[model samples]
Target: MNSDQEHYIQWQKKEEERWEALCGRCGACCGAFDKDPCVHLSRDELKKYYCTIYENCFGIKKTVNGNDIVCGSIRTILHSHWPGDDCCGYKKALKEKN
Candidate 1:
């Protein structure tokens, strides 16, 4: 719309990109190390993990074993424990920030 609105939108996009960039794509959050990863989690040729339905990942989903899971922001589970969480980039960033 206006110049200020445009600038704000651009800044918001940059922030979102920065946040997304923190992910190492290890898929631990999706249950990779737990041996029951999300059904949409896929590994690339480089051995990195990614979500097949990333654009619409938030909400109810399923695990490889057919377990129902509630998907949401990584921030929501930051304080919780996962199998490979010690290698999580976001947790490392927060640790460094503090």
Candidate 2:
């Protein structure tokens, strides 16, 4: 790639990191507060939740309750419906958009 393209990619990576860092790691969006949670959800030593298959989390996935859900970026369902989503970082940002 050209130097300009390389720089742009690096800048985009940094921006993506910063955006991801905004998450509180609460796992609320993953259904931590519900009876059914994404099966890929895992907790770390620090008590934070993360996706086991983060890089390939999109598409159909099963929940703790054995139900299938189409996994997608949180933004796609920000204003939709989900259990315990009020605590999501993205949800907070959505409120500020008003």
Highest lDDT scorer? 1
Q: Model 2: per-residue lDDT, tens digit, 3-65?
A: 999999999999999779878888877777887889999999999999999999999999988
- Single out the weakest 10-residue window by summed lDDT for candidate 2: 81-90
State in Å the error of residue 2, model 1: 2.4
Model 1 — TM-score against the truth?
Answer: 0.92
Supply the global lDDT for candidate 2: 0.85
Model 2, residue pairs in steric clash = none
What is the per-residue lDDT of model 1 for residues 1-98, given as tens digits with 9 covering 90 to 100?
99999999999999999999999998999989998889999999999999999999999999989998788999999988889999899999989998
Prediction-by-prediction clash tally: 0, 0
Q: Candidate 2: where are CA atoms >4 Å away?
A: 1-3
Each candidate structure's TM-score, on Cα atoms with residue i matched to residue i, is 0.92, 0.85
Clashing pairs in 1: none
